[model samples]
Target chain A: MIELLLTPLHYEYMIKAIVVSGVIGGVCGLLSCFVTLKGWSLMGDALSHAIVPGVAVAYLVGLPFALGAFASGLLAAVVMGVVKSKTRIREDAVIGIVFTTFFAAGVLMISLFPSNISLKTIVLGNILGIADSDIIQMLAISAVALLVLVLKWKDLLLFAFDPNQAQSIGLNTTRLNLMLLILLAATAVAALQAVGAVLVIAMLVTPGATAYQLTDRFGRMMLLACGMGIVTSMLGAYISYFLNGSTGGCIVCLQTLVFLMAFFFAPKYGIVAARRKARRTTDALLISGDAHPVPALRGL
Target chain B: MSHGSTKLNKNDISSEIDLHVNEVTVAYNNGHVALFDTTFDLGAGTICALVGVNGSGKSTLFKTIMGFLTPTRGSVTIGGKPVQVAQKQNMVAYIPQAEDVDWAFPVSVMDVVLMGRYGYMNFLRIPRATDLEIAIESLRRVNMLDYKERQIGELSGGQKKRVFLARALAQRGRIVLLDEPFSGVDVQTEAAIIELLRELRADEHLILVSTHDLGLVPSFCDQVVIINRTVLAAGPTHDTFTQENLARAFGGTLRDLRIDHTDAPDGTSNEFRVLSDDEEPLIFGHDGRLVDHWHPGIDEEESK
Candidate 1:
């Protein structure tokens, strides 16, 4: 078993791939907690896809791809916010409109420029082909983003829970909101190098949602999500090595598997556990000759 | 419709003003007025009730006081300072409606209450021992210290209200604003909140509560402010919360009820029956005094 695990370490490219994918998973997992709590899952999907045009444009203009991705992602977020607040359009509709437009623009740019950048790689990521500089860039962005999220998580939690109360306590909720959006864009840019645009949403949402089913506390939810993220990324990377398949695809599939496990097996909130609890309560009531047959419990 | 038709009773009001709304006017983005030229003053050691019908701008006034909405023409001040400055100084706290929060968010009851100290703590500094002690004391005051570790989502409606009340209490602010604190609460929880408000008033805290429960006003509040789109009357509850003021604030519905009462058989008993469109009629009796007592959902089945 040890030799099998160490087999991948023999290749320099494999080791680099593992490190880059792991870093992406961890940062995205940490952010997933906030996204899940705030019901910003669609926002994450929107921002990830919206950065495609920026990546294409940056490659065209000879600028750093991360910078362009961050700019375009931020612009998309701002536009979405304005549209939701200034008009009567619902948030989901606004997100859908903004992201699809940006994504279409990106596809058009790629076809127009006809560069070495492949549409498949941009849509589905190329973890094994990441250069040393790309690894370094990913590490820098992930470190800064994770550090800030760890340090100011409480304030962010309070803001997400209740913005009006946070403002009443003298916290600048608007600034906090803008800061969160910026971090989101940056995280999307960082993850873009690993999972590309389309599959990044899975990385940004699944870990926190799975953790949410397993824990009732925010701090514990974050820790569990980070753990799940790292584990899935490493396992997915190893499995993909053997199958000769997409690492991002394997990672997202593994995350879904973990979520399914939690759905049925989590002690407090899982379907199976809830059924067991109901049975036990009913048995106790029957033994005591006090089973009144509650109408609500009948359905459960 | 006359401004200042009801005068402030100096003998009943304290000289020190804890909260002042000076001719505040709030308008929505579409140039529609929500609250027009409203003014009121509240002092320490008093609990004030903001009474108005639906769409009468009660929430707009509270939001303006909390600095969430900027007044178009006037200002809100606390302790002779602007609302923002007072908020920064930790002199004002607001307890929002329960429905405004995302209850499913993962947070402990203790964490929610501890958020009150965020105004006093320095940037990024965790709560100290003193902060925890104050939070615990606040919880104890609301009889919710035992459930401090429970998730907020698991709490009942009354428990949620207590948790929010504890949060406001933990702030130690001299002025606290509550928006519809008793809307969904049970009778026992309402009584508990009333008791807590009395205790806060004894500690010289000024409380402004917006409630649709008009029955609680005479018993629990010392002052009342009636507003339609503007301040109809603002003074001591016993002096300003008259039938005429209520009629003006509530519009023709109240006038119709008064007329229905005059046509009743027991007209000399000073009883008024308010018949809602959907619900049963509620009968209120005034025994030759300003104190009007009525029961909600009482004799409802019989009336039906």
Candidate 2:
């Protein structure tokens, strides 16, 4: 077991994959806290998928993939915003409509070009073969996104909790929301380097949600989530060396597993713990002669 | 139709105003006139009720005052400055509706209150020691100091209202606008909030509370501004909060009940009138003096 745990560090490709995965994971994790809190989880999914056409176009034009992906990600976000605001269609439905359309256009664009890159690789990225340039770009995007999130978290929390109050206090809620969107775009671009478009949403959603179930402080929730992301992505990447499997899938599966543990076992907010608490309350009430089999508890 | 129509010159108000909505007309992007030729001026040490029926431009007025909406024809000034400038100077505070806040968001009661000091904080919003002290004092004022570390989501509806009130208090703004503070609160909580507002009034803070609880208006508020797309009346509460003006403002929404006129043993005539807009009913004795509140569960005269 020790040898297996220590073996991945010997391989240069494995070390690089682990480091890149951990960095992107931490970035996505922190951003996911805001995404989940702002109820923008679907927006994360949308931006990730919507960048496919940009990547395809970049491949076609021989331009850098990060630039194209970032631009398309932002464009998709704007399109989603416009559609949701202009029409009576619900926001979730609008996100679905825009992202799928963009993704289909990307697939069509890719099909028109020579098959230098496999569609599978774009959709389910090969982190094992990430180029040195891609790693540098991903790390740069991660660092900048991390810095912005750290600097503006307080205002962003205010925006997420009560936008009306934020606006009332002279903070421009519209601009804050736009900043979050731009950060989300950057995160999607950074995450795409490791997890590809399809699995990026899990990386951007699960850590925050799992951390949320475990804590009641937004600051602590972000820290826990970032830590969860880094640990899980690193472990998944390392374990994938032995499993000979998809790194992104392994990372997501590990996150889902952590989420399940928190769901049932979190001290205060978990389902199992809550049920236990309820039973104890009922028992206490019954013993204390305060229980009544009438009114609210009559059916029971 | 009119009582103490205290419209003042723009220049006179610009200096002395705690809040001045001078002939403000707000139109929607589609050119629908939401608020038409509305005007009201208030100075310090006032707790005024902003009374209106739904869609009667109450929210539009609030939006304009908070600088969320631009008025087509008029301006809102606070502390001798424009709404935007006043807000930038941290002179405006708002307590939002319950629906406007995500109660389940992970934040402590103290965090919500400290948000009020954001205007004074640096760009990173690291709460200074003074900010923390003010927040603690605000929480103490609202009787929520013990719950400062508790998650805001863990609070009851009344507790939630108090937390926001504490937040407004911490803001230390001269002009405070509260949107439906009493809508979901219990009577005890309502009384407590009003008591706090009275203290704020004594401290010379100008407060505007938009509420549907008409019955409590005369009992607590010092002034009233009744509106229906325009200011129908604005002045001292007793003169402006009459049923006639409310009937016009509410437009058939108010229901009334009157006891038959009776001659007392002392030879003075006695009458009881109840006017309600389907909320807490207001009972008035002879000469429009607000009397004991009308409660469905209590037959007060018989009980007496």
Candidate 3:
């Protein structure tokens, strides 16, 4: 079993793919906690899809792909904010309109100028084709994002939980909000080389959601999310090697599987455990001669 | 109109203006004026109640004071400084309504209270021992010290309010603004919070609370500010909280509660009769005709 697992490490491209996917996964997981808590899961989906136009534009020009990705992602976020504030439209509707338009524009651009860039590679990722420069970029971006999130988790938590209270406490919530958006754009751009646009949202949201079901504390949730990200990415890379399938697809599927496991088996909050707890409590109540069950325990 | 009459005679504390809202007007993006040129001054060592009907801009006024919203016209000063300056110096703290918070957020009671100390620390600075000590002391003040390690989502409604109060207390601010602090709290917790506010007032803190409970205003609050897009009346509770001002602030919705005077059977005194919308008539003993007894039952029902 050990030799079978170690077989994929012999290939240089597989080694590079594993490293890039692991880094991207860790950063996405760290940020997912904030995104899910703030109800910005759709924002992640929107921003990821919105980056395709930027990537196409960068290919047209001589600039790097990540720059185009970041610029377009940031533009999408700013436009969403403006539309929500300036007009009476709801946020989800604005997000849908903006992301779809940008995504359609990107597809049009790709079709109009089809030379070296393939839509297949951009939609699904080209993890095996990742170069040393792409690896450096991913590592650098992930390192900066992780460091900032780790050091300033409390401020972000306060802002996400209650923005008004954060502002009242002298925290410049506008700057904090903008900072989070910028980091989100940067992380999305970094993950683009590994999972591409289509599956990046899963990486950006699943780990945090999975960890949330298992822990009641934010710190533990973050740690557990990061652990899940690395473990799942590594295991998914190995599994994909054996299955001869898409690495991003395998990784996202494994993340979904892990989330499902947490949903049904988490000790404190899982469905099965909660039902068992209810039965135990009812049994205790009956033994104590209190025939009436507690009202709070009825729903469980 | 009768301003500063309810000012307490506390000599030990400095008689500085803690909150001053001067000719402030706040308007929404849709061009609706929420608060129109309202002004008020609160001195140290006083408990002021901000009372208004629905959509009367009580929350708009509080948000402007907290620097969450900017006034279109005028300024708000705290401790003779700008609102932003005071907020940065940790001279102002706010306890928002319990429902405004995300209860399912993954935070302990201690973590929530420790957020109060963030204003004192620099960027990226962790809470130190002194901050933890202050947080624990604040939780103790609100009688939530035992639940400090529990997740906030596990708390009851009253406990949640107490936790927010403890967060406000941990700020150690000279001026505390509580928005509907009694909304979902039980009677026991309400009494405990009132007692705690009294203690804070005695310690020379300026406590400005917005509440729908007008009955508690005359007895619990030292001053009252009645607002309806503007300041209709603001002064000592006994002097400013009259029938005409309340009727004007509450509009025709308040006129449904009719109070009349009838001669007692003994023929020596007049008994006041309160006829509510759907409830039975209640009688109160009085010697003469009470011109206008404003029962807040209708207001409570309207809020619900």
Candidate 4:
């Protein structure tokens, strides 16, 4: 088993794919905590899908895809905000309408202007065939995004927990929302390079959700999510070397497995554990209402 | 933690604190006036109850005071500063309703309390030793230090409210706004909260507690501001919180009854009147004085 794992590390391309995937995965995971906390899972999906047109436009114009993708992602967010505000449409409906329209426009552009960029690579991702420039762009974006998130985590956490209180304390909540939106767009663009659009949402949501099931602290959530992201990404790449499968598919499958495991078997928050706890508490011997319904966690 | 020197005295904090709402008027975008010519002046060291019927602009008044809404006609000043200025200076704290909080958030009780010190922190908002001490002390004040490390989601409803009150205490703001703190809490929790408010008043914190619980209004609050789209009356609780003003504020919504006791043993001929507006009834004794404690009359009769 050791020799089999070592065999893939000998190849430069495999090393490249694994390294890039791990770092980008960690960034996506870090961002996933905030995204999930703010209930912006659908927004992640919307932003990632909406970037397709911008990516295609960048490819056609011979410019960096990040710029075009970031712009269009921002536009999608803004359009959703505007539509939700301007009309009486609910936020989820606005998100659905905006993303589908942008995605369709991207498809039309791809069909009209076919080139070296394959629709499959853009949509489903071709992590194994990524280029050198793409690696630098992804790393730079991920590093900066990571720095910002780590530095401002407390404010972000407070804002996510209670916007009214956050606002009352002189925190610029509007600016904070704008900053999170920008970060969301940037992360979506970076993640698009690895898992493509459809799978990026999972990369942006699953790790944090899984972490949420396992821990009761935001700091722990952040660490567990990032660790889950890195391990799964690299392990998925390694497994793909042996199975000769789609790396994105393998990574998503692995993440799904972890989430299901947490969902059903995590000690405190797992469904099975919860049911067991319910069974045990049938008569609730202590009878103190303040006894903490779940097992007591003293906290960190 | 060197709370040694930086800690501010209650006198220093409260002496300069004053909240003045001038002839403020708020109107919605569709040309509906929610509040008109609402004016009230409140100083420190008093607990004020903002009493009003639903849709009588209580929420609008709160929003205006919190700087969430701007009044069309007048201005609100806090301690000689504008509402926004006071907010930026961290002179205001809010203990919001339960519905506004995300209970499942992955923050510990300590973590939530620590957020109260954000304005005093550095750019990164890292809690220092002093902040930690303050947070722990605030939790202790609320009698919740034992549950400091527990996830907020794990707490009971009353515990959750206490944690929030602890956060407001740690905020160290001159003016604290509590929105419907007793809505869904049990009798024990409500009494605990009322006790905490009394302590806050003793500390000279300007507390504005809004509630539909009329019987609770007089127990702890020292001042009262009754409004019906505007200020119907504003003064000391005994002076301003009269039955006449409350009748004007609530109109026909208040349930009133006068049961004259003619067959008393002493034969002094006193009355037993009760008034309710969907909450704890305000009961009057044979001497026609507002009975000071919460007595669920219907339940007491059941027990009898």
Candidate 5:
């Protein structure tokens, strides 16, 4: 272990992976809170997959992958937003339509290229072999995304609860929504480089959802989720390193474990704990004859 | 079809008008008009009930006032400024329809209320101590202080509505717009909410509530607006709740509002009747001097 740590290549890869994963996880976790709250879990997945055409297009045009992915994701988000806003159709239905169409287009684009870079590998990602440049780019994008979200935190929260209220209060809900959708697309693009489209959804949802079970305060939930993200990333990276498996899969597995634990054990909002508490209270009331008074229980 | 043909009842009116929406028209994207050339005035320091048949533009008018919908024609001015400017010009709080929300989202009563102050706080900053204090105060006002830590998903419909009210109260807005605030509330809770509205109005907060509770207007509200695609009439509750106005507001489908009558101790006449005969029949009551019928039958079911 000591020798491995001292080896220049080993040290560099380990450091690079940890830093990149930690930053990506933390940022995605924070954004995921908003996504989950807005019932946009599938939206995140859709946007993630929607980036392939952009990346493929960028790759074909010899441009940066991030730029390509960002553009494609933005296009998908905008299409989704416009369709949902203008139509009587449900938002999920719109999202389903947009993602499938865009993802299929992306697949066709990749097939047209027929390069050594296969669709399966790029779509799923090769997290273990992430280049130093990719790591740097991922961390930078994540940091920028986090900063933007922090700056617009209040606006975002207001938009999530009641967009009309936000608009009435002089917040341009349309502009703000566009800004958030773009940010979400950008974040999806960044996370895709590290975790692939499939697993990025997990990073965006699981930590925030689990954190939600532990706290009601948005600030607390965001902070707790960031912490959960860091832990999951570190543990997943380590597990993959030792088990000789896919890092992205390992990260999602760890996140699943954390979510399961929180689901059963978290206080206040946890399913199992809440049920137990309700049962205990009912039993206590019944034993104390509090519920025995028929009129009291049934009438005003 | 004649203009000003319907005379408003005059028993339940206050003095000054606070919110005046004149000739406002809103159209959906699909070319359907929700509100057309609507005109109504809500009195200051009074609870004004808005009564109309479903899809008759009641919610559209409320949404317009809240700046959620932009009217295609005419104007909506709160206090004095246009509704668009008034949204930020003064303190304005809105309680949306109960069913318009997704309750499964992860949020708490306190969390929802605290969001009211998000307009006042810096974009990036979290709620401060004062914000929290106001949230708590609002919760206390609505008698939902005990449920502050409870998740929104876990709350009953009435509890959720109260939490929404607390949020509006925390906004500290002088003009409040409420959409179907009593839809799923029990009588006790409804009464409690009405009492809170009374107190708020006493403090000179302009209260505009869009509701199906037409009967409560005689006793609880100072004024009423009868709308059906366009404004039928607007005035004191007693003046506006006439049989003619009710007929126009609900269309001719509502008949002979004299279903049940109770003579008051003060010699005032109170009449209760079915406003509509749908699966959920709308029931309303009038204090004889003024005929008002718009009590939401859905609320009665919740109490049972």
Candidate 6:
């Protein structure tokens, strides 16, 4: 297996596929921490799917896909923001309505376009046969997006956790909120080219959510999420390489599998770990004839 | 952390009071008045309780003070200046209602409170040791020192309030506005928080709280401002808490809440009425009408 892995380095396309997918997955994994932490997983999904119309429009106008995706994602964010503030409806409802309508509009536009352009490839992703330019675009866009996110991490965290306190403390919460939405849009757009709309939600949510189950600390969760994304992306790619299966689907499947494992087996808060600890304590109490209660933790 | 210091020159301290609302009227987008023609002077080193019954515009008053709402008729002044000053952004610290937060956000209590120091920290800089120290000190003030690393989502209602208070404390502002800080708090936690507020007062911080707990007025407040779409009363508690004043401000609806009198330390009765029965019959004005064959004076005899 090691020899085969090393031998694949000679094939530039294979190397490109691995290196590009790893970079996208790793960065998105870090971004996922913010998404899951903010409880905006659904919003991320909405933004990711919402990129379709932009891509379609770009195709119609013969523009770069990233430009279209970014524009449409930004538009969706604006719509979501307006609906959230101006109306009494919950944010999820607004996002749902916006994404669904735009997605339908995208599908319609794609059907109306010339048949030879192959819009279905965009839905299923172009990971296996990814071209040099596609790889370059993914790397360039994802790199810039990730850099911006890291630089503004504190501001975004503040706005996400408490906008009122953020405002009162002299932070420009309005600007930060808009910046966060733009970052989300950019991340979605960058990831869109590799995993496509159907599977980007998992890439955005599962790794971060699984990391959340394992730790309560923000920094640790982000690190764990990035690690999870990298691992899942590489393994899924390798598996797809051997089996000729869908790389994006395989990646999402691996992410789902990791989430399930963390959901049940995470030592800190997982269901299985908690239950096992409870049982152990119950047995100890039965044997000792008294309960040694755990002291409550302090210092948030 | 040092914004709380006396290093601020008298002029600097005086100059920072720039939150002003002039003839501001705040109505819902639908045009229902939330605050109307409200005006008040808020200075440093005082805790003003914006007290009233539900929908008496206590929150509206706070919102107006924070510039969240534009008062329709009168304007509020901070430091004898308008609210548009550039230096005024970090001058005020506001603690909103507990329910306003989305508790499920994945962040440590420390992370939430440390955000208060964002005003002082450079925009692109990561939180420094100073920020951490300030955040921890703020948490310590609120007795949340132990939960610094705990996720905010795991906190109880009172704990959540304390966390937010810690956040405001970290802001190190001279004026702190807390909305319903004692709501859902146990007696012990409430006492702790009241002690913390008193300490803040000693630092010459101005604390404004919107609260329904009229019982706490005489003890916790240096001054009480009763608001009901407008200023009902504003003065020291003894003068402002009179039954006639309460009746006027609360619209006579809360009169049935029995007031119990207890003696003072000097053997003269303290004269302040404690809550006797939360639910009791209202004493009616003289109508000269008989009820169940008993007159107003005769009812005392008939019951015996």
DockQ of each: 0.70, 0.74, 0.72, 0.70, 0.51, 0.44
Q: Sort by DockQ, best first.
A: 2, 3, 1, 4, 5, 6
Superior by TM-score: candidate 2 or candidate 6: 2
Candidate 2 local lDDT, A1-300, one digit each (tens): 887679889999999999999999998999889888888888889999999889888877877788989889988988988998799999889999999999998888888885455577678888899888878888998999999999999999898888877887799988998999988888888888687789999999999999999988999999999999999999999889889999999999999999999999999999999999999978877786646646587435
Model 4 stretches astray by more than 4 angstroms: A1-4, A282-300, B1-14, B265-267, B279-304
> Which candidate tops DockQ?
2
Q: What class would a CAPRI assessor give candidate 5's docking?
A: medium
lDDT of 4 by residue, B165-275 (tens): 999888888899999999878899999999988888887779998889998998999899998899999999999888778878887777665556566689887776556
lDDT of 6 by residue, A96-188 (tens): 999998888888889888532356666777676765665677788888877887788777766776666666555666688677777777777
* The best candidate in terms of lDDT: 4
How close is each model in CA RMSD to the real structure? Answer: 7.6, 7.2, 6.5, 6.2, 8.7, 6.6
Report the error of model 6 at residue A93, Å.
4.2
- Residue-by-residue lDDT tens digits, candidate 1, A185-278: 8888888867779989888899999999999898899999988888898788777887889988999999999999999999999999999999
Off by over 4 Å in 1: A1-4, A85-87, A291-300, B1-17, B253-278, B281-304
Q: Which ten residues in a row have the lowest lDDT in candidate 3 chain B?
A: B1-10
Clashes of each: 0, 0, 0, 0, 9, 25
**Model 1 lDDT per residue over B1-304, tens place:** 2111111122114334478899999999889999999999888999999998889999888889989999999999887889887777667778888888888888899999999878656567488776788899999999999999999989889999999999988887778889999978999999999999999899788999998777778999999999988999999999987766876776554323333233447556445554332343445455544324433322222122
Residue B112 deviation, candidate 4, in Å?
A: 1.3
- Per-residue error (Å), model 6, residue B9: 7.6
Candidate 3, residue A187: Cα displacement in angstroms equals 1.0
